[model samples]
Target: MLHHLSIRNIVLIEALDLDFAPGLGVLTGETGAGKSILLDALGLILGMRADSGLVRAGEAAASVTASFEMGALAPDVAETLTDAGVEVEPGEPLIIRRQLKADGGSKAYINDAPVGVALLRELAPFLVEIHGQHDDRGLVNPRGHRALLDRYARVDSTAIEAAWKKWRLAEERLERQRAIIAKAAEDRDLLIAHLEELVALAPQPGEEEELAGERATMQKGERLAGDLSSVQQVFIGSDSPLAELRVAARRLDRIAGEHPLLEEVLAALDRAMIEADDAEDKLNRALDALAFDPLALDRVETRLFELRAAARKHACAVEDLPQKAADMRIALNAIEGGEAEVAALEQAAAEAGRVWRALAEAARAARTEAAGRLDAAVKGELAPLKLDAARFRTAVTPLEQGQWGAGGMDRVEFMIATNPGADFAPLAKIASGGELSRFILALKVALAEEGGAATMIFDEIDRGVGGAVAQAIGERLARLAGVGGGANGGQLLAVTHSPQVAARGTQHYFIAKSSDGIVTRTGVVQLDGAGRQEEIARMLSGAEITPEARAQADRLLEGV
Candidate 1:
């Protein structure tokens, strides 16, 4: 419930502090009495857009603060505040303040701690709701209708939301696979050609470098073979040194027995012959090491050329060709198995769709049943508001498959038929401004505790109605305010001009403008017993508090 509202330097309001009670509190004054200014100040604290023009003349800034007692706050309110990083303690007061500079810049605070405007806006629904002739929030907006219906029906909304997210996730997975299949289908021929080429080439890792090195060695060996051949001739091939040395050693052996010196010369000649034979053997091995089949060189060169050409075509080093080939094979494999994968994805998506439809059907049934009850309840209050001939309904229209969302497969709208034989239309389209206010009041009355705001404010909900209708509005407002009830009851505040309405308030306030020669200021004071009677009488007689008006005011207060 709203515990207090304090304003400073707001338009027409220099400084004010107003404390509120739980039950309906009424603020009444004549035209141009700054009632709208009060609501504007309250709106700022409720996270409404700021305006520089709202600052009082000669003031540099304006500020408004609304304090709420949180003992009766909705459970979600505390959780939401905590999630937004705002500390909330049960049984403590939650203070929301907004300060607007003359430059149109603004700042907001929750519980005396600085916060963003969005956080303030998030907290608004939990604390208070203000309704007026053109109000679209609370029960009027279609976006909130589903939740409202669920709240009234006492249904578990999280179940529907969880099921919807799962279904949507499944759909996303299926769509992703479908996109892959589509792309693969477009490039199928190209992938198949690349795979076939890589397979036939069968490039082995490290084969390119090995073949190039071998070819170069062979080419160098060809140049060195000429020198090896000449050395071979000196040792054995076509060379006369080994034959001549052997002949010289035989001659020396024949003379060795006759002369000792000749024997020494024969031994040296034999050693020379042995050395020459060993050198010739080594030369033969060297020539064999240098030998190669002429065609072997050509084959190596051709294979190296093929590998380099493939490397260039693929725009990678020769070493990376193997990885490229592997990648191509994988792509081809995916294409080959794509049809089966797509079929599996389609099956999964179908299963998810069935689950979503079943859940939506159950939710729809619950909503349909709840809609009937809500429509009946709202219409029940219409007769007392003097709209007995008007019809109220909760129009639950089925949505197309493409339009389905987390809420369900239906769109809920508050529809009304204002006159007999008239077709039911949207509440906003068919109801006049005065009729809309009354209709909203009927909803508020019917909803009762189901309307979640801890504090509900109606700006002249009784406007343009009088007599019994005005009295009914007054009674309903008092009931909503929870007059005489303890802290557990909700709070209501109304800006009204009807004397009957003002007389029913548990607390009454008078809004009046006073000027100090240079500037006009608006002030509000809680009316005492006699002051309440006088204000009501003034509302009844306008400017002149007549004797009959006082009697009527006495009668209204007596009823309260």
Candidate 2:
């Protein structure tokens, strides 16, 4: 229940604070007494759009705050707030504030936390609803009719949940397969390029190491060759060591029998000659393994350079080229295999569509049954509300091939026949001001216990209604409010003008103009006892306060 509203610098309302109570409430005043201004301000606090023109003529901004008594709020909402760390004084209230600047920027807050306009809109449906001469004729609204029908048929909500799961799973599978197919397609071009490069390079694993080892061996042989060349050069020089050795050996041989020391000298000369011969044989053997081809070096350089370049192109080190090329070939095979997989997927998608159509058929049947019953019930309800000559209907029709959607491949609309001779037309077209108001009320009464809202607001529901009819409308509102079946918790707030309607309020407010020459103003009060009587009397007698009006007000209040 809305407990309080505070407004500042809002049009004619300079500053105001008003308290409210549960059950039916009424606001009454003469013409131009700012009754609608009070509702407009409350609407702003309840998250309606803001206009810069609403600011007081001299003020830069306007602000309104509405406090809701959450002690009686729905359990689900109360629990949500508690879980979100908002401390709830079960007996206290929730305060929502809305502010607007002359520049037209608006701001909203829920329990002091800043929120977006969309969140504000969400909260509005749960809190206060504003009905005007121009807004929400309800059961005459197609969406309203659908909700009523759902409640009547008890539309199997679980079907939607089951269908949603199937739909989501099918969609996920399609997306995953599509990604795989796309990746395969990208790999096709890439694999051919990689395979061509690898085939051209054709470097064996460990070949670089072998070439390096062979090069080192050749280099070592070159060193040995230098040593051998030195030995040969030394022996072949002008004063040849070999010549000296031979001369020494001959001398030693001639004098060998003459002296044992000379024999030792000849043996040493023979040993030196044998050592040089052994060195020459070892040098030849080492040189045999030392074939150094410049062409082989060129091959090695070309292979290594190509490998390095490929590594850089693929963002890897050169040694990883073999593994990378193998992976690319695997990817190419995957691309080649995709056509078969895509065909399989297209078949699966067709199967999903078939399954959806089967479920949709069931939904459509249920909806049709509900719509028929709803049309009959609303018309039945309208007859007693002095719309006996009028008719209410629900029009459900199928679509052409391209017109499929989430709500079961059909259009649902509300149509009316306001006079006996009138052709059935859309409610917005054929209904007059008075007929429209009653039609909205009749629909509400019929669908009151349906899948509507926890609270309904009717601004000037008394439009074009007076006397007995006004009293009937008030009785219906009271029925909607008090007959929530002992804990269902439905409520209603109707802005009205009739004395009979005002008398039914469990709580009542008096809206009046209180102003100085410089500023016109609006004020509201919760009325009771004699105060309530006077307000009702004023409603009965227009601008006058008469004794007979008071007696009539007393009788009406007594009746309520």
Candidate 3:
């Protein structure tokens, strides 16, 4: 509830401060006594557009501050503050201030901490609701009808939103999978052809390096083969070194028995012959190893070329050919198996959609039922506010599938038919300025307990009606403020001209304009019992408040 309001340099309100209380608080004055200036000052703190003209003449700037005691902050308000890093403890007062410069610049603050005007505007709905003949927000706007209906129905959209997200995610996955499969199908034939080429070549890891090594060895052997053959021939013929060594050894053995020195010479000759025979055997083995087939070298070269050419075609290193072939085979397999996966995904997406639809339909049903209750409650209030012939309705119409959203598949709007035979129309379009304010009041009275601002200010709601009609508006306002054991007690401030409505206020304020010849100023004073009586008498008797008017004011107060 609003606790206090401070204004400075705003139009005629050069400097003013007023403490507000709970229940119905009425502000009354003569028509040109500057009641609207007070409202405009309050609007500044509520984040309404600022006008440089609002700054007092010759004043540099204007500012307004409002203090509200937040017993339990609304969820949206708490979330907004938390997101903006503004900490407010439970039971703390939320202080909002707005400053307007004469140059059309402005700044906003929350609890003395700097903030954006947008943030103030966002928090305004929870802090207070201002209803006037020209108001297009709150109950009058069609865009907020769905949310208001949901609040009224106590509909929890958590499950609905969750289901929607899951369904959308599933649909996205299905689309992605379809694209993948389509692209893979487009390349299916090319993939098969590449796989075939790789399979035919059958390139092994390190095969390119091995073949190159073998080719180099074969080329070297070709250069040395003739020379090696000549050496082997020398080792094989009868006049070779091994044969000559054997003849020497035999001659030495014949003379070894005749003399001791001759025996020693024969032993040395035997060792030499053994060593010479081993050398000749090694030479023959060397010649056999050098004799490689020329056709084998051609085969090695052809294999190396084939592997390299395949590597260039696939844009990969020669050693990567085996892995590349394996990947291509996997691609082919995916293309062949894609239909099964696609069918499974389609089933999943369909299931998700079904779940979302079920939740949305349930919410829609709840809103439809709630709309009936809301319509009846509002209609019950119409007659009291002098709208007996007018009919109110909560229109819950089905939305097209393409327009369905997280909230549900229904569009909710408050409709009214001003006459018995008239067609129902949108609340804003069908009502006059006075009728619109009355209709809004009726709606507020009906939805008071659902989700309304902690404080509501009605600007001249009792206008153009008096006597029993004005009294009815006053009684309803009192009930809305929780006066006399009424439910949904909060705070309500009304700017009114009716003495009956003024008499209903638990608290009263009088607004007046005074001129000091050169300067004029507007001021507000909280009224005492005598003060209230005098003000109400002035309202009843116009310029001359008579003794009977005061007596009638006493009766009105007594009735309240």
Q: Pick the candidate with the highest TM-score.
A: 3
Off by over 4 Å in 2: 69-94, 136-148, 161-165, 168-172, 175-355, 449-453, 483-488
- Give the top-scoring candidate (lDDT): 3
Model 3 lowest lDDT segment of ten: 283-292
**Per-residue lDDT tens digits of candidate 3, residues 1-560?**
89999999999998999999889999998889899998888888878888899999999998999999998887878999989878889989999999999988999988888888888878888888988879888889898888888888888877888888899899999998888878878998998999999999999989999999989888888999888877776566689766777778788777789999998888888777677678778876765665578899999999999999999999999999999999888777778897898899999999999999998888889999999999999989999889999999999999999988787788989999999899999988999888999998888779875676889999999889999999999998998899998877889999999999999999999999999999998999999999999999999998998999999999999999
Candidate achieving higher lDDT, 1 or 3: 3
TM of each candidate vs. truth: 0.72, 0.70, 0.74
TM-score winner between candidates 1 and 2 = 1
Clash pairs, model 1 backbone? 23-481, 24-481
**Model 2, span 24-87: residue lDDT tens:** 6776777777877877887786567888988988899999998886556666566655655566
- Model 1: per-residue lDDT, tens digit, 1-560? 78999999999999999998778789999899899999899888778889999999999999999888888556677678877778877688998999999977999988878888888778778778888888877767767778888878776777778878888888898788777777767888987887678778889999998998888778877989878877666655333667777777877777789988888888888888788888888777767776765799999998888888988988998888889988877666667887788788788878877877788888889889999998999988999898999999998899998899888899988889999999998877888877888898888677665756788888988888899999989888877677655333678888998888888888898999998898899999999999998899898998889999999989999987
**Candidates' lDDT values, in order?**
0.84, 0.72, 0.89
Compute the lDDT for candidate 2.
Answer: 0.72
